[model samples]
Target: MMEEKMEDRNKIKTELIVVIVEKDMSGEVIDAAKQGGADGATVMYGRGSGIHENARFFGITIEPEKEIVLILVDAAIRNAVLCSIQKKIEIDRPGMGIAFVLDVAKVIGSPHLNLMSDITD
Candidate 1:
């Protein structure tokens, strides 16, 4: 008979950076992520509807085109990547856009994730 043991997956932590910015500046955003040590990024188009305020003309709606960037990076370089993006995009300024990081408990499909974890560890 063979015995099997389960691994503790919680020990591995990853960061998912969600960045929303001007559609035309998505290339810059991805560049920032790469400069910050991110291996890859995914970008998508979207529209903004934040609580800040909205302008209207003739009782019509106006929405700004946005690019949503998704970057999954190793926990070790998460902060550095975010800072790099901030410096290049001036994320601190109003109307620039919003960015946030989420805790990724698990990831799949990316074979290099293990290599990343090992290097960071």
Candidate 2:
């Protein structure tokens, strides 16, 4: 039936994983994701605020720096990638940054995939 085919196709859809972590941990986080199942990741600088702010030892104020990593992966590997990052970064603790998965409606510009049209004239 048409519905059955649609459901099967959806199984291979892609998703986006967003990880915000301490600036220095971004590299390790991405590496763990790649080892788990993700093909690649894009990281960028960012800043965030939460209940637990950094404490200053002296007169200077220290705002923690953060890095955001975006990873687009096949839905099949979403869970594995998330777990790998969490295990590597020890995200279970309170102050560590957060990570979430979003259902990606579409993806583009990834050079990692090679497709075959398979059309004969």
Candidate number achieving the greatest TM-score relative to the actual structure: 1
- Encode model 2's per-residue lDDT on 1-121: one tens digit a residue: 8556545544557788999998798899889999889988999997766668765778776777899999888878899999998899888788888999898654444556321122231
C-alpha lDDT values of all predictions: 0.80, 0.78
Error of 2 at 107 (Å): 1.5
For residue 12, model 2's alpha carbon misses the true position, in angstroms, by 3.3
Off by over 4 Å in 2: 1-11, 57-60, 113-121
TM-score each candidate. 0.79, 0.77
Q: Which of the numbered candidates is closest to the native, going by highest lDDT?
A: 1
TM-score quality measure for candidate 1? 0.79
lDDT of 1 by residue, 14-118 (tens): 789999997698899999989999987999998888866466889997777889999998788999999999999998899898899998866656655552222
The local distance difference test score of model 1 is 0.80
